[model samples]
Target chain A: MNSKTAIKFSVLLLLFVLSCALSLLFGGSETMHLSDITSQDFIFWQIRFPKTITAIIAGSALAAAGLILQIIFRNPLAGPYVLGISSGASLMVALSILAGNSFHVFSDFFIGKSFIVVSAISGSFLVTLLILLISKKVNSNVILLLIGLMFSQICGAIQTALEYFSDPNSLKSFVIWGMGSLANTTNKDLLLFVPLAVLCLASLLFFIKPINALLLGQNYAQNIGINFKQSRFYLILISSVLTGLTTAFCGPIAFVGIAVPILSRMIFKTSKQQIHLLSTVLLGSTILLFADALCNSLLLQVSLPINMITTFIGAPLVIYLMFKNKHW
Target chain B: MKGEAMISIKNARLGYKKSGAEISVLKNIGLDFYAGDVIGIVGLNGVGKSTLLKTLCGLLPPLDGEVRIEGELMTQIALSELAKKVAIVLTEKIGGFNLTTFDVVAAGQMPYTNSFNRLEKKHKEIIKAAIEVCGLKEHQFKLINELSDGLFQKTIIAKALAQQTPILLLDEPSAFLDYASKHDLFLLLKKLAIKENKCVLVSSHDLDLLLKYCSKLLVIEEKLAHLISVDEAKTDAAFLRIGGGFI
Candidate 1:
């Protein structure tokens, strides 16, 4: 790494740490003080600490997943959101948590009662498998993206049907989940969330070389001894796991995937995947932490949806990227 | 040719497998490429020039006959081992932006890298040597997306050279270069084949330049590939046999 990029990485990493600290310090109400927490460390561990960790994991996983798909598909606009993987995850959540005996699979129909993460993974995996099969048939990248949009629409309809049949409390929970929050995970849920997120992120790390090779083009990547099909399979596996698990634990937080990598590349001024990966991780974590801070600060009495904060920040950036289409 | 055969294609039928049936493009081809030969494939448009190149590089499987590379069957060779023996540059446009020319060339060192793709000092040296040989020293730090057509083309060639493969396959490699750059590319390929003792296969539409610089000429006509010497290609009936006078 050059001195300048190294300096940039250090600065971004520092900002990430600061974001983590800030996310842990406060939430919708007063600052989470050690002195104020007299009842067995009440709000800090229950709310802020796990939420901060959730922000870090969700942000980095989604961003890295987005970056990998973008490189592999050679489309700057591709992401888990646009590709329907997130919606598939969201659909599983809806079916498990909100459906409530409307469409029982068997005696144990509520996927949420046991292994919600696994159910979400199966949903995301199925969608990913369908997309992969479709991509093989489609010749154009644009058409592939359109098919992804189709998946998103179909999943959206199914989730809506489940919501329509749901009871009030279940509907309320579904609404809150759709709004996207990092504070949904209890300490009990973290037992399930952390290990899976770490595994997905590690898989993303292993793809650094193939991702870099993919930037040259698929045929070139294969020529350089990268098994293009296999790498793509792994990419789908990793990305689906990340998107699925994050959506399971922390709701479908959108736009961090598309926006963070774009900003990282624009700021770093390089397409090198290794540099971009590092930049995306740090920047992604920082952005989510910043958004969480914003969510806490803006309402003060009530926590706004994280999706609102991220989209308010991300959509404009994507629109700006669209105008600067040449770089994209 | 003093060296052993680098690649042997025996009665190979090449085609695309589309929709459960094979759409054959070329059939019954027998060819051997030596270590020190620059073989140029010349054909009209849509005449399987790129297909033949793809089949040779194992990107496409032959429909019937087997291809052996360095005495191993091409299909049976491991991907990493095949990478060490053969390299290819396609005409496809690359996507990533702001990649330095140095980065593009260093990608050739991929097979030699550790699991994390970190290059060793020796691998870095090979990449540097390739950049130097391709005359990209001044432009080495420039982003490939910002490079001129000629410089971009050089970056692709330099990448192939850094691969250290014995056989190089280029599909319409000179298609985008200007006349001067085209000649420079051909001369470099010629030098690499003769001095470096690498087998080079090139497919191009520049028959005149190709015939002059290449040691041999390959013509694809009527689903058959014919390999002939440049002197044999220089004969009076050669252009007529290609289906018309030169355009």
Candidate 2:
């Protein structure tokens, strides 16, 4: 890396460290003094640390997935949610949560968590399979995007209809999950979430060359010896897994995926995947950790939904990117 | 000058396969391209110039017959193996996410790089050399979206140069270039062919420029491709007919 790129990376790294520290120190309603380390140990280790880790994993995964989608689809507006992956997960979760006692698998803690995760992943994969099949027939990226939107709309309609017929007791839990929370994950959940997120993110390194070639268009990428179909399959698969896992755990957090990638491009001012990947991941984690900290520190009595904070920040950044003259 | 043919096309039929049906555009083409040869492909719009280039570069398969590269059948060669042998520059505009001239040019070394796309010292030298040859040293770090049409065309040419392939194919490469850049482009192609013993094929509508720079001309008409030397092209009936208004 050149000195300019190194400086940019240093700045981002510094912000990431700051965000992590801020989150660990001020992440819960119960404020504790550092001097009384033993007295505050339980809250710090049990609650604050896990929430921070969850924010880091979910944020980085979503942002990187968004970046991959934007490059693969060659669309500026493509995001983790654009392909209806999140909606598919939401629809499945709604069936389990809102369908009342018919699916009583949610009664046990371990079974409930695993079942929710499996349901979300299966739902997203089913939708991804349908989209991949359609992609082979369509020639234009615009057409694929329209088809994805149509799928998302269809999934949303069904989810809404399910919600309409559910009981109020189950509806309350479903609505809370939709609001999104980073605090629900404990140490046990980290065993699965951490490894899967890391694997999906690391798999991207193998595709750095193909993805770079693809930026010039499919013809150029193919001319450079990339198997366009195979690469697309792997890229889409990685993105869906990342999106599915995050949505399953955190409940479809919004805007961080789309907004962070565009922000990284504007800051770094280059499209080299190596640099963009690092910056996007770091910036993603930093943004979420800071947002989560704000949710905890500002409203001590009532913790705000993580999605509300992210959309509030991410929406305006996206708007600003749209108006800017530089192409991304 | 012709010890062995670099590329030999044997009765190749070029066209698109739409929904499992072959739509042939040009047929019965037989030709031999040797090293140090600068050939220009000329035809009317939508007359299969691009299709022919695509076929030679392994982007599209011929409807029938075979294209042999270095004595091996084209269909038998893997795409990865073909990448080291041939490079192409098409007419399409590439819009990417803040891709700089340097980044795009660096991608040319991808076929040779490791899986991580690392650029060693030698790879960096090759990329720098290509940039200098294409007169894009001043704009090497500039974003592609910030470049003019002419410079953008030059950047793509530089990328093809960086690939360092034995055969280079370009389709309508001069379409977006200015007059001087177009002249420089042909001059560069000719230099690369003769000095480096590379086979170069370019397709364009610039008949005057082609006649001035190309060693030979391949003219397409009525689903037929006719190969003629530059001197013979001056008096060829098909060439005269196609260039009637201007030549």
Candidate 3:
């Protein structure tokens, strides 16, 4: 790393630490104090701690997934949310939550949670597989992005139809879930979410050689001894897993996946996957944690949904980037 | 001077498959390529010039027959192994965000890098040597998106050089280059063939340049390909038909 990159990395690391600290302290309806010993422990351990950690995981996971999608698809606008992978998860989750009353099996708390996780993962995985198939026949970037948009529209229409028929109580719960949140994750959910996200994100490091080769385009990647098909499969698989699990635990958070990777690229000014990966993770975590903190600020009478805050911040960042770098 | 052919092709039908049908462009090709040979491929546009190069580089499977490299079947050789023997410079323009000229050239060393792709001292030296050879030392750190067309083409050529392969294949490499750079590129290919004993194949419409620098010519005409000596090419009927007005 050069002196400029080192300085930038150090600043990002510091920002991440600060964001984590602020998130833990002020991430609940009532801000908890570190000074008080007895009354604060319950709020800190149960509510604020899980919410803060969930933000970090979801942020970094989506960021890494977005970076991979951009590289593989060679499109700057690609992300789990935009590509319909998150909506695939949402579609399954809608089925489970809205129509789940008929199953009765989902009434059992532990089984229902696990089922939701499975449905989300399988939903996103199936969509990712479909996208991969279509990408083979359609090589143009604009066409692939349009296909992704079409997938989202189809999935959204189905979800709306499902919502129209479901019981009012179930529909209400599903609506809240769709808006996105980090507060729902308890310590138990972290056992699965943390390991899966960490594993998938870390494994991305192993494919650094192939991912870097892809920047030259697929044929060049193949010529340099990188297995283009295998690499693309594993990359999309990992990307979908990150998107699925995050959507499972914390609704479909927007903008972090799309905006953060671009931000990292802008900050670092290098396409070397190693630096981009690290910077994306750090910036992603920081942004989400800060957004979560903003969502829970005492100034608001009712706490806003996490998605609303992220979109408010993420959407503008994306628009700015699009205009700032026309080619990006 | 001929001893053993470095590459041999027998009855290879080169083309692509579409909707479960084979569309053959060049049929029943037989040829032998030796080290220290700089052969230029001449054909009209869309006459399977790129397809032939793609097939030679193992990007496409031939419809029938076989291609052999150093006595081993092309299909039998693994991509990783083939990567060590062949390098290519194609015509397509690539855009990689924040990718510098140095980074693109460093990719040529990927076949030799470790799992994490860490560039060792020796690898860095090779990358640097390639950049210098391609005259990109000053623009090494510039982003590829910022470089002009000629500089970007040079960067890719430098990448192929870093691969350090014995067989080099280029498809319309001079399409974006200026006149001076195009001459320099052909001269470099000639030097690599004669001095380093590399087998080089270049496809271009620059027949005059090819006649001046190439030892032999691979002419594709009417779904047939013929590999002939440059002197023979000057008198060949098909070559004259294609280059009749110019030559």
Report the Cα lDDT for residue B13, model 3: 94
The pairs that clash in candidate 2 are none
- Tens-place lDDT digits, model 3, residues A121-184: 8888898888877977997876887898899899989998998988798788778988999999
Where is model 3 more than 4 Å wrong at Cα? A36-40, A98-100, A107-110, A133-143
Docking class of 2: medium
Q: Candidate 3 clashing pairs?
A: none
Q: In model 1 chain A, which range of ten residues has the least summed lDDT? A: A105-114
How far does residue A63 in candidate 1 sit from its true spot (Å)?
Answer: 1.2
TM-score of chain B of 2: 0.97
lDDT, candidate 2, residue A51? 92
- Decide which is better by DockQ, 1 or 2: 2
Model 3 residue A246 lDDT score: 94
- Chain A of candidate 2 compared with the true chain A, TM-score: 0.90
Per TM-score, what order, best first? 3, 1, 2
Model 2, A211-290: lDDT tens per residue?
A: 88889888889888898879988988888888888888888788888888888888887788878888889999999999
lDDT of each: 0.83, 0.86, 0.89
Question: How would you encode candidate 3's per-residue C-alpha lDDT over B44-133 as one tens digit per residue?
Answer: 889889998899888988999999988899999988888989999888888757888999999999999998889999999999999999
Task: Tell me the tens digit of each residue's lDDT in model 1 across B75-111.
Answer: 9988877888889988876645567899889999998
lDDT of 2: 0.86
User: What is candidate 1's lDDT per residue for A1-328, written digit by digit as tens?
Assistant: 7899988888898898888877877754778765655556767768777888888888988898888777867778778877888889889878766444456543552344345677677788788788877877787867987998999899989888888988888888888888889988777777667787787777677888888888887788888988888988888888888888888887888889888888888889876788888788789889999999889988789888999999999989988987885555
For every model in order, the fraction of real contacts preserved is: 0.57, 0.87, 0.70
